[model samples]
Target chain A: MSRVVVDVVLKPEISDPQGQAVLGALGRLGHDSIRSVRQGKHFVLEVDGTPDEAELKQIAETLLANPVIEDVELHLTKD
Target chain B: MRIGVLTFPGSLDDVDAARAVRLAGGAPVPLWHGDHDLKDVDAVVLPGGFSYGDYLRAGAIAARSPLMQDVVTAARQGLPVLGICNGFQVLCEAGLLPGALTRNSHLHFRNRDQVLQVERADTAWTADYAAGQRIVIPVKNGEGRYVGSPADLDRLEGENRVVFRYVDGNPNGSSRDIAGVASENGRVVGLMPHPEHAVEDLTGPSTDGLGFFTSILKAVVNA
Candidate 1:
């Protein structure tokens, strides 16, 4: 079996309110060293066989992430 | 004419949507998320509320529900579809509309009356209103900000697909001050505000929202 991991984040130009709130909270909690925080979604998919990158990309673009405001990176997390 | 109102498990405004349809002199057909058929309704409404408990992102799961397949097909075939709030998220996720509704820029769940201008009066949902007509309706949601690619935003603006625009000032900081949008063919519309909630003067800030229902009724009758 193969596993696919996808990380979806707001496009660099788009504003992320949740991520900003988290950054603010982190600063309040004294995690000042972290200069920036952009929250995103992570998903792991276990497939019956090695999944093709093109197919996975299709899934990521069409379902896992909204292309209008998000960018996704897909990786084979495990084999 | 009959209007279909899909009621997912967490749908909070299906009844209200149905009520609006009835008030506008159309039969309200109840549709379920588990079902695949559209029940032959003249038009369909994906009402507001936290469907699928808003799990895995608001409207994410509901957009992939079985019924959406039929909804998408019908919408493409020129059947009128209106999505409100969470319904708007579902539409965006299902690729029925442009843009994603992200968290409000103010990082708050805004719930209040909002003024909007009818930017495109030719859509299936806003035809009753003239272009630039101002209307007040309830806007309520945690994730209501609209975001899209710059090219897409420009294209939408150039094509006049922005059916509604925030008046006075932007409410949730949506791109281009957009409050709602219509499909290229003007057969589908998705908006963050709750028009169904403002259909009655006794229960809401104004009855301005009745135009949405009446517009659909006119479309169905004219068709």
Candidate 2:
């Protein structure tokens, strides 16, 4: 079996209010050293055998992430 | 005229959209997201809701549904389409319109009576209103802020494709205060406001939203 992992993050230019809110909370908690925080999504897929990188890329690009406002990175590993 | 109102699994305002169509003197045809047929309707409306539980992103899953493929094809052929709130998110996801609706900058679910200025009344969805007309409509969303690259936004403004702009104050921190935008041909329009809810004076903040439904009727006639 194989596992495919995908990370989706907003584009650099796009604003991440959730991350901002978290950063604010962190600052309030005395974590002022953290200059920034950006929130994103992580997904894991378990495949029967060897995971196809191209197909996973298509899934990440088409459904898992929006190209207009997001960037996706995929990693595969043997289960 | 027969107007099609698409109902996705989590669509919350399909009924109200249909009611708006009926009030505008058009037959409202209910369309399902899983179905492939459009029922030969003259226009289509993607209503607001948290489709697919907004899993990957708002409007991401629903935009790839079977019905949206047909909607995209028909919309490209000059069929009039209106997307309200989450529907507007779907439109952007489907690539029918430019830019993306993002999370509100304030990190809150804002629901309020928003005033919008009609920037371009030439689109199929805004023909009933004259340019510079201000209308109050209810906007309810957590991720309704519109964002795009500077160059694309400049092009959109230069082409006069921005259909509506926030007038009194920006509601969700949309870039350039853009509340709605139209396709190049002026057939497809997506706005982050609940016009369907404001169609009737008895329930809505104002009846200004009726113009969106009524404008399609005139657009069909003129086409």
Q: Pick the candidate with the highest TM-score.
A: 2
lDDT of 2 by residue, A1-79 (tens): 8988899999999989999999999999999899999999999989987778888899999888888889999989885
Tens-digit lDDT track for model 2 on B76-144? 999999999999999999999999999998988999999999998999988999999999999999999
Interface RMSD computed for candidate 1 is what?
Answer: 1.3
lDDT of each: 0.91, 0.93
Q: Write the per-residue lDDT of candidate 1 for residues B1-223, one digit (tens) a residue.
A: 9899999989999999999999988899999999988888999999999998988778988999999989998889999999999999999999999888988899878988999999988888888999989999999988989988889899989988898888877878898899899899999999999999998879989999999999999999889
Docking class of 2: high
Candidate 1 wrongly placed segments (more than 4 Å): none
The residue pairs that clash in candidate 2, if any, are: none
TM-score of chain A taken by itself, candidate 1: 0.92
**Interface RMSD score of each model:** 1.3, 0.8
Instruction: Assess each model's interface with DockQ, reporting 2 decimals per model.
Output: 0.76, 0.81
Lowest lDDT sum, 10 consecutive residues, model 2 chain A, at A47-56
Best by DockQ: 2
